[model samples]
Target: MADLEDEPQAATVAVGSLDDVAPPPRQPPSEPADPAAGSLERARELLAAHPIADGGSGLALALREAPLYDIEDGERLLETDIPRLRDGGVGAQFWSLHVRGELTGDRAVTATLDQLDLVRSLVADFAEGLRLAMSAGDMADARNCGRIAVLLGPVAGPALGDSLATLRAYHALGVRSVTISGTRWTQRTGLTPFGQEVIREMNRLGVLVDLSGCTLETMRSTLVAAKAPVVISHHPEPVPDDVLRQLRANRGVCMVACTGASIRETADRLDHVRETAGPQSVALTGAYDTGSPHAPGLADVSCFPRLIAELLDRDWPQPDIETLTWTNVSRMLRDAEFVSRAMQARRPASTARPTPLDA
Candidate 1:
């Protein structure tokens, strides 16, 4: 299978959750106006009636106008994303956060942060239509309220300024999970070193470690090292060579079945990881396209849930299910707040200034 090294410039696979991405610069939402507001409903209807994808504005145009986000209209992203999948049920979200990794440096970080800030802002702006899901239970809560719960994750974790330390800080910024690499070898735990330290650090921090965007060597090394339940967010994990044991099925590491050209490798890897990780593993599918191995090119607002549904078709191992969908990812977010409290205790009152950003 082609690894991130082989396809550095290839379009990024789905991120599934925006739990660990730094913010990117903002590209205005194709339609910032809420459909529920004044003439918005009528305007939205007219726009949607046409070939709709990016909030009814067309995917190309939305992509041109917005950066980082796959869908065009921020307002309709949740509205359109949830209904496409069978596995997703009513509340499962494979939300992903990503940016063009080739575009690196402070500019990338700044732009990524912009995207993150925009997501948070958009949540409030589209409060009636969306909710950010931090835990498995939060999904149910949002569904009962008829709202889509947004998951914040990074398309690549190493993009956060090259240190696990930086990732810890991001957790404070409301990030819930992180993909260690995205379509390239990175400095810390990327294809270069296998990122074992990165994996261990993430497990300890409570951030869900994503194993997509890695090569067999990179994935193998990191997976072997990662102890907490993990999610291979979008790609299928190929079966390991006899040398490697597939403990994922027993360890309960979560695995998200993804849309890609190599579905079999993905599936095999999923089974291997589950066999290696066991019971705690989980799988998620991409609903953006017809059920096929071809990667889901880009996400549209209405088709989000299709991704969820596609994964549900398989007999999801029970242990993998809870860890993937709710438990492991949930711990990443909730625990950060607890850590923040402890950090505050160690510092002198004067060193830590009172501010809304403290948490």
Candidate 2:
């Protein structure tokens, strides 16, 4: 994710009812005159026509994307975006809380809290269209209820303020994963010793480890520490062979972000990954952001079907596509959730608060 300005401290917070908080107004539906509507609609149509996984299997999931609302810019999801996602056949989104480099110490934690509040407010206001999901089952429930499952993901573990308990608090608060340092906005190259400890704690806590912008050493060390499958939500170009080998051993999924590249280039990368890591190890991700300019033939979430359609046009096997689109990530989430439950059971009574959404 690209760096952005830090969110200012909230003067007052409303954690009560949805009636007390108001989200940014939704953007109007896309019309034919709109710049990207025609292509988006075509992709949506193709997505609906193709049933993902067939035989009533679960829906496809994306690993990373920015939140729908931009508090700094007063921008919100366009009215067409939800339909675009549904049409694109996206069942769940790990809406990322990208911590800017400027935020540090207490400010970082405050910023994370603010983003969490913002997403919760949006979900509450748009309950008909969205659900706050903490686990794979919750995501499936949202899909069954005809809504998008929104999971919390914090990028840059510095937001946890150098505390393992703080990390557990984040887990209790429903954060499913954390990216350990190295975001686009930061000059921070490698994980600190404390950062490594956080990874070990995350494994014990059943929280997913995210290696999005980490250094090669960071990825290597974290992969070794993590007991559960970690996710490289967005891979940088020139992916390392050793990292691929580690991921193959860890059973991790490398989500290929669909931006700034052609379908063929993306396909070639996935093919290369398969050749190196074997099948069911690579997945597709839009890393979609309403704020950024659209990638050709892949603009918003709605462009997903177009990707699948193009892959099919290339004669990619349907089963492999199914693994890339759905199963691998789903299985990873389930594995993490199981570990989380076991950890929660072993936790002390002093930590006996209800999980987020339950609280």
Candidate 3:
């Protein structure tokens, strides 16, 4: 994989005036066909064959605020509900287990555990609609059974309290993904030596690395160091084109957030990422209940079909759409699991401790 120094900068676009352009001859106006009719149907058909595997969400945080909020009820709470998830064709969702950034040490770890418990409780309470998934196979099985798979992921590295043993403990508790940066701990230094160890441990445990808020430097370093594929979950800003290109070599996926002024804008962002990095490296995240405003048409999780229809109208290939909705994330998880099995067989769990430099 190319390092940050070697990656090319994004090309700039220049605008030109149309002062010298001439107008074409006018022709008779004709009635336009309703393009949405055919495209919407096609989008739904594609979704039935391959449902969405959302990269991340903040519904758990919302539940933390209103413990009484019941997802089983037909009423929508924030951006998700049982009915809306079904309407949206979401087969698998990674509910972010995020705590306040101010909380640290034992307090952070404990709060994260509480968030995990809350997610598990929600899945158990709504057993008919939700199923806890720990592996890629589990996600597929959930979809096959008509239940939404719930995968757990911490929003930042601080949730681990700087302990690899705690990392293992969380994995035992069914945490499948961890964001290695994006917190105050590593904001200044990027990925420290200790962060590298965390990535290796995550690889050994089959936990997915999420570079949601890392700097480009950190992302490039992690890409070169990681053994398995990584993910950038729920990034609102456009991922730099250079990073998208680097993903081609690392086999990582950049999940486009569903937060724009309109569904059309969201589709345009997806188009840009797909064009930059092949369709195999692009995916979607509803980014629901993260306290961010969702797009007008994509106000809730039920609006995913609208975006898909837009893509279909733009003539996106069926296979490429399928890869965006499901194949990429599923393949990434399976690859992580494959790497874990091999690493575990070759070596033991890392016992290295953080040094003063890592701080």
Candidate 4:
């Protein structure tokens, strides 16, 4: 994940019900007509046809701090809302379940559960616009129904409390993705035997093993161990070109985090990722509501189309853009599901625990 070093401190505010929230804010004025209007319109048309299936979002983490933050109305206090999501042409989103690094053991598990509850409640509250998606098919169904598919994932591996049982429980509760390393575990030399077991269990359960903040050793270890395709939800700076090539061989996806300070820079980063890692391995994620600074014109969820327009202006082929926005991530999910079924048929879930020696 991009550094949240500049994350704005959450204000102390009272919680309120969705009904008490104000009506949706007025839409901002459209940009003045320009020579690029044709590209912008084409971009919108392309997105309308193949809306983005964003690989990661931190809305749940933001909402954890401000429970009353409503998305129905254009909640300026936060980065995401229904109207903005619709405006952004986001058809699916992976809501990251992240807790502070200091949290561990039962505390971490409980905090993660709270984040899950918050996300589930938000989905329930906004059922008309959001639908929980536990599978690739569900995501496609939600998109067809004109609802944003909400996929849940834990951004920190510690949230599992080093227990496969807890991990299974989370899967049962609808977590489709789990980061293999977090702040505490990222420094490890490589995956321990137990860590390898966790990877196996996650594969059997069809959960995406996210290697966002993992060390190179850990990432390589996971790539070797995982039967299902893994995902890097955010751009990890430490990852070199070789790792990307390895990722391509592993049939994984790098959901490039668009953390650039400007739309053009973001497009450049995407292009670079596509070139380094094969086009099939590239995907897009805004990291919205993660408390990270966003580039101008890409400051909120509504700005995805603007970025797409920039890509169009760069003469990127519509097919490539379609692959970036929807195809790659969706295929990764479907591949994971396919691998999971085969793995489950071969072996039952392993009963494994980490030992001090393993650590």
The lDDT per prediction is: 0.46, 0.64, 0.87, 0.85
- For lDDT, the strongest prediction is 3
Of candidates 4 and 1, the better by lDDT:
4
The C-alpha stretches of model 3 lying farther than 4 A from their native spots are: 1-33, 183-189
lDDT of 3 by residue, 67-104 (tens): 88768875665788988898888999999997887888
Residue 102, candidate 4: alpha-carbon lDDT: 82
Candidate 2 segments exceeding 4 Å error = 1-80, 183-193, 290-294, 342-359
Best by TM-score: 3
> What is the model-wide C-alpha lDDT for candidate 2?
0.64
Q: What's the residue-level lDDT of 23 in candidate 1?
A: 75
- Choose 2 or 4, whichever is better by lDDT: 4
Clashes of each: 93, 0, 0, 0
User: In angstroms, how far off is 167's CA in candidate 4?
Assistant: 0.7
| Model 4 agreement with the true structure over 100-214: per-residue lDDT tens digits | 7788878988999999998999899899999999998999999999999999985478888878898899999999999877634344687877788888899999999999888
Q: How well is each residue in 220-284 modelled by candidate 1, as lDDT tens digits?
A: 66656655555555543443443134324313234444445544444554455555544344343
lDDT accuracy of residue 320 in candidate 4: 91
Rank by lDDT, highest first: 3, 4, 2, 1
Off by over 4 Å in 1: 1-79, 82-88, 182-194, 236-280, 287-359
Can you write out model 2's per-residue Cα lDDT over 139-184, one digit (the tens) per residue? 7687778777777874456786656677778888888878765422
